[model samples]
Target: MNIVSQEHQKSGQQPTEQVTYAAPYVDIEPAESGYVLRAEMPGVNRNGIQITVEDGNLVLVGQQQPLSVSGEALHRETRQLSYRRVYELDPSIDADRISARIDQGILTVNLQKAENLKPRRITLE
Candidate 1:
């Protein structure tokens, strides 16, 4: 997995765009038919997450918006930020059949193996 870093640019006294990024932890497990990938992305909503597979890479982007409260807080620990992680996909992966879902701050992706790559058992009579 690859972690993309935050980028900065300036143009003639314009306000600099401050970006805070974090890489969510991930786990990949192999199955008989495919692989299961799970990522921990706390504070990310449905609209705040994006998953895309392109150029033999699976990319995950998640964002956490700032909390909106009426009163000021005495202490603060959370910050609005974005999360990005990328994984290089092998030729055995069937990208067209890949599926993903998010629940309870966790993102799960099912990566199906290509037909020829799946294990097969042969019987001899």
Candidate 2:
């Protein structure tokens, strides 16, 4: 896993745009077949989260839009932040069986091991 402070991302208006990326806290739970990856991205909506797997890497991204108000600013703390995290997937993980869902700012990704890698009991003939 890698936590990047800033990264260059492409935008429609600008060919290259510099973005501040924050890595969200993540917890890994080990299971029989595989492990469950849970990422905590507060204030991020379901549509704003993106997950992709490519080149033996799993990428997670979260975007939070700036809050709008109809008055002069007095005190402001919360700001728009983009979260990104990348993890190197194991060889036993079945990329095709990976699935994810977001609920209450928590994104849960289910990583399943390939059938060939799973343990099985053999019966005596």
Q: Please report the candidate that would top TM-score against the real structure.
A: 2
Candidate 2 lDDT tens digits, 1-125:
23475433423354354666778889999976799999988778888989888788899999875666699879876545778998999989999999898888899999999998888899999
> For model 1, how does the per-residue alpha-carbon lDDT over 4-119 read when each residue is reduced to its tens digit?
56333323454466555788889999976889989988788789888888788888898875667889889877545678888899778998998888898898889988998777
TM-score for predicted model 1 compared with the true structure? 0.74
Model 1 misplaced regions, further than 4 Å:
1-3, 6-19, 121-125
True-vs-predicted CA distance for residue 61, candidate 1, Å = 0.8
Among all windows of ten consecutive residues in candidate 2, which has the lowest summed lDDT? 6-15
lDDT of candidates 1 onward, in order:
0.79, 0.83
Clash numbers, per candidate: 0, 0
